[model samples]
Target: MESTTTKPDEAATEKPVVTRRLDRVFLELYNVAAFVSRFFKEVLMPPYEGKEIIRQFFEVGYKSLGLISLTGFITGIVFTNQSRPSLAEFGATSWLPSLIAIAIVRALAPLVTALIASGKVGSNIGAELGSMKVTEQIDAMEVSATNPYKFLVVSRVLATTFAIPTLTMYTIFVAMVGAFINVNANEATSFPAFIEQFFGAITYLDVFSSVIKSFVFGFTIGMVGCYKGYHSSKGTEGVGKAANSSVVTSMFLVFIEELLALQIVAALRAV
Candidate 1:
């Protein structure tokens, strides 16, 4: 018989908790993937949200023009100014146009535009949807037999998907203009000379890759924002959390997409 009191092993006790947390993360990821899949499926189904999509497109694209343009111009100026000293040291000042154009077209413009939109559009969507959820507007729509998901989620997502590429293109043009002005201020480079070399360095492949990446970035931002908002809970606190999470998640997704896009671009170039 005897005194058989067993002590609990801390390691063994913690293992299950850690495993459950990991499982929860995996489950959340799966749920998000499923939500995105549902969005695509719903998008293709009846009662297309043409009008709402157009409206949201204007909201996401036109409303964002000023911010994007200002940031793009500033980016160009700062980038050129920073690189000039290095280029001058290496007797590569003449390469400025090509470098600026290539960087803007291939990476900077799209990345900056997407990030701005994620900050602006992502937060707006998340907060708007979260508020609607909290106020029961979404539920009321369902009660009235209106397809709220289509009107709210699909439209916004599609608008962002289409608008971001347009914004990226606009950003590239504006950034180039900024670089051109900055170049002239620093050197004897003429507008024509700058434009010639700028366009010369940029290949069709670069433009295509940037456009594709923008599309993906836009989709990711819109979907994540909507997902966060749609699932928001905990009353008003949830709305704030949703908005914050949307920006963070969207930015993270943008970087991930950029990395994958770069790999794809490299693979395509090799082919």
Candidate 2:
């Protein structure tokens, strides 16, 4: 009968495999923290890459406008349509504008905008940087006395950080417009009345919290994309992986941040 005991070599190798994986996980976390710290450091002390940042802004924001607009409009219409029956059942149809406004302004707008940006902008940054990494272009930039990190990572990150909030504001406006269309059709609610209810339902705190959440979400998306792409390996395969992982990671982080932000906002509101 074969021995039931594990061979010494097999046992030794098994332990190391588990240990190595654990070590790799922690090492990856450490590297990410360092990368984030470096970004804050370099971003503040800069021969600022103004042109690159502007170019990235155009890439991230302007190019994404059509998709964002369409998504926001659709979301508003769908949400309003879905909400109407519930309100109507209670004879509270008049509250549709305020309900939509609060729901969109306080939650839906920021979340939808961030998720869209995470897919579009995050994947683009990851693919772009991953390609640069694999092609040795980044190395060449370093050899040519350029700070590649500043020129590439910082600029893209800054672009996302700023562009996303602006996009969120646009999303809110577009979504509100869409919701108004649905409301108008159902109740003949005047646009002016809808607009008044929309603004009246939202407070300074709601706006402030949404903006803060957008900023955090933007930063998380940008940083995750940059980190994944910057450290990518294995040539073209790695570039694809980087882009895919950037989207996945950014979306995950956005959800986590959203949850945390809501908790913090709740706490603040309670005060």
Candidate 3:
């Protein structure tokens, strides 16, 4: 008796694992671009959902303030405490206020705010939309001659797009306050002096860059969350997956935006 060896089917292994993953990534990117384009189209052609947008503003902005404020304060304190030793070694400890201001305004505030919003607002949008999707509430809206995408998706996306920038500015202020507390404790720096130094260090370019970065981050968070939720499947399990995906995708995009923003700003400054 002779034993026969069987060869694996070529068709079954036509695509390698890496190739399949790359395909999936490109497909996902295409879907995201399409989703974002649709959002822009609907937003411009709307009998705008004013009331819903306001309600979402309250939900996304106001409800998140307490948490954002706490996080900002803690971050400022920790960063200042960490920087003091390095500055002292160079006899430049007096630069603490200016340094904190630049750091917070240029990078820290926007990044921190975006990350927090991604975790909080992103997940909320994803879960809420996903639930509606899976429960057929979205379909029901269509049956009743309602535009669910406008009522739900547009409002929430707009809310996040606008709310996050406001939150970032607030975080900058609160973080400065926290930094001042540390500075005052160490050097007895007056509040007015700290404020003056902070503003003196921050230029119009810095503020502009920060606002632009925040807006980009906000759009990323909202768009990613909406896309994940709107496309979610697999029933209730998909809701959880959408929420998790929203946070992770938002964070990844935010970091990418931050790096790009920095490069652009640096290039402008060099000019």
Candidate 4:
């Protein structure tokens, strides 16, 4: 054959990668929504698995403590040191301890811990479920008359809901201790005074708003991780993709939820 000359229309006819991404996004969103709804339905039904749920509780809660605390400690110290000089330079140094402590308690501690845990827990959930999906284990469970969603997905969602807030609280405590160390580095704020401001800034509004936002964040992250893993289809590459997408999606959802939560809290306060 002679030269196959491309026409102008043919040259311009490449499939839009952006369109494919949007399609994938919608498909995944639909699947995850269905999975979450199934989770609630399975959860409310009787004949629950106490042992599995307990194991999930331990896995999600206890296993996360070390990383959360370590991160929290560093967060506290660094945030304190970083935020101090400017305030000091402006003669607002006395506000440092309480201000930093409040920031830790109400926002930074929970959000940052969630960010780190999203990388850890979300990736693990995705990889683990992806492996199961690839190995046909999830399918086998279905064939055996088992509700895998109840056993695997719902339990994790529940565990994350309960665990993250407590984990965040512990993170906040340790972060304050780090802040205390930082405060004493170049200034003379007492620990007790710092504690006072911490509690004083903590209105019920702040406490409830922060805790609720984190719980929602945890639920979104855990469910998204498991959902991605459970449905992974690209074999080995799917596992990696799931883990990466879970973290990225959960982070975006967390920020979105933060804006939504702030709006809801403000509305509630106005009532």
Better of 3 and 4 by TM-score: 3
Model 1 CA deviation exceeding 4 Å by range: 1-16
Error of 1 at 148 (Å): 1.5
Compared with the true structure, model 1 gives a TM-score of 0.92
Question: Judged by lDDT relative to the true structure, which candidate is superior, 1 or 3?
Answer: 1
Candidate 1 C-alpha error for residue 40, in Å: 1.3
Q: How would you encode candidate 2's per-residue C-alpha lDDT over 1-271 as one tens digit per residue?
A: 9998877666456676788789789999999999999999999996999999999899989999999999999999999999999988999999999999999988999999999999999998899899999999999999999999999999989999998989999999999999999999989999899999999999999999999889888888889999999999968999999999999999999998888988998999999
Instruction: Quote each prediction's TM-score.
Output: 0.92, 0.94, 0.92, 0.88
Give candidate 3's TM-score.
0.92
- Cα-lDDT of candidate 4: 0.83
The local lDDT score (0 to 100) that residue 241 gets in candidate 2 is 96
- How far residue 84's Cα lies from its native spot in candidate 2, in Å, is 0.6
* TM-score head-to-head 2 vs 4, winner: 2
As a whole number from 0 to 100, the lDDT of residue 264 in candidate 4 is 91
Ranking by TM-score: 2, 1, 3, 4
Off by over 4 Å in 3: 1-23
**Can you write out model 1's per-residue Cα lDDT over 1-271, one digit (the tens) per residue?**
9758776665556678889788879999998989899898999999998999999999999999999999999999999998899999999999999999988999999999999999999999999999999999999999999988888999999999999999999999999889989999888799889989999998999999999899999999999999999989969999999999999999999999999999999999999
Residue 17 displacement in candidate 3 (angstroms): 6.5
